[model samples]
Target: MKRARTIAWIKGLVAIVVTAVVFLVPFAFVLLQAAKTPDDASNLTFSWPTHWQFFQNLRDVLATNDGLIWRAFANSAILTVGSVTIMVILAAMVGYVLQRKASRLNPVINFFVLAGLIVPPAVVPTIWLLQGVGLFKTMFGMILVEATFGLSFCILLFRAFVGTIPRELDEAAVLDGAGPIRLFFRVILPLLRPVIVTVIVVQAVAVFNDFAGPLYFLPGDENATVQLTLYQFQGQNLSFYNLLFMDILLITIPPLVAYIFFNRQIVAGLTSGAVKG
Candidate 1:
């Protein structure tokens, strides 16, 4: 028993050390770079700043290109909120129906859902379609793209969670004269809290961090998302390493703060439907 306890203790210590090295070290490096003088940051070493310029670097990054970073942050927030809202509503409805209804088309729908996960998006075709629909370079268009891309995974999560819900609640709601909308909104959706929170946090972070989607689908500085703002500090001949790291640190905070606060909820949501009682 003592030998087993010793091994477990050693294993836990090793895991903690590995986690700190893998995650904390990179974050510390970025922090150090962001706080350094321009010359110090340029060296890109994991050393403390010779002259700390954290606030100055932050001001410069935020004020670059007439405060493009602020605009990028606003656009990213809007896009993340819009896309995640659409995904949660649509995925929940589809998952509920697919799980509850007995339809021959379920298999076909399932195939397409899985295909959405497997198939890489055709960017050229998507852009062409957006252009044809007059949605090119529009916020709404980017929202649609983000929502659609994330829908399949959200569906799978919702469907798995729906299975854990008893059918008696549905019958009871119907017996109480509840319509489908009310049944879902009032009765079912409340029960879907776990998976809903999971989907929102996960997908919101993804949409906010997405670079290529905004780069290709929503071009122009006005529509620039947070990830696109990274280009501001980068140039062909010159790069502002301090300001670049500052921007990265700034943009990384929202997602980091979100995960920190909702960490437990995310874990519970993800594992809640893993085993149905």
Candidate 2:
């Protein structure tokens, strides 16, 4: 028993060390670098700043480019919220149908969903399609791109969680005169809060931080998302490492806070239906 306790203690300590190195160290380094002056940040070491200038860095980052950073934040917020909302609702409905409804087309639909997960998006064709629809270079276009990329994962998560929900509830609700839409919204959606929150936090963070999608789909200063604001601190000749780290620090706070607060929900949702078999 004593030997077992020792092994467990060692494992726990190792886990803590790994977590600190992987997450905490990088976070602390960014915070420290963002606090340093231009020359100090140039050194790029982990030492404490001679002058703590976190607030100044923030002000500079926000005020740079006539406050383009704030505009990027607004754009990211709208894109993240819109895409996540649409994807979650659609994923829920589709997942529920796939899980509950039996049909010959179920396998075909499942194959397509899995294909969506496996296949890389054809960017050029997608651009052509969006342009044809007159959505190219627009915020709505960006949202759709983010939503499409994130849908497969969200649907898989929701489908797993929905599987754990008993079919008796559905039958009872339907017998109570609820139609398909009413049954899902009124009865089923309430039970899916855990997975729904998980999807929201995960997808929101991903979509908000996404650089490539916004760059490819919405290519304009006016349509810049938060991730694109990183370019403001970089140039062909000189790069503002201090302000760059500061911009990173600012954009990172929201997702960090979100993960910290909703971590349990994320874990719960991901692990929700594991033992159902």
Superpose all Cα atoms of candidate 1 onto the true structure and report the RMSD in Å to 1 decimal. 1.1
| C-alpha lDDT score of every prediction, in listed order | 0.94, 0.93
Clashing pairs in 2: none
lDDT of 2 by residue, 1-277 (tens): 9999999999999999999999999999999999999999988899999999889998999899999998999999999999999899999999999888899999998898999899998899999999999999998988899999999998888889999999999999989999999999999999999999999999999998898898899999999999999998889988888899999999999999999999999999999968561
- Tens digit of lDDT per residue, candidate 1, span 80-111? 99999999999999999998988999999999
For candidate 1, what is the TM-score?
0.98
Give the poorly placed runs of model 2, Cα more than 4 Å off: none
lDDT of 2 at 72: 95
Q: lDDT (0-100) at residue 199 of candidate 2?
A: 97
TM-score of each: 0.98, 0.97
**Quick one: best lDDT, which candidate?**
1
lDDT (C-alpha) at residue 254 in model 2:
98
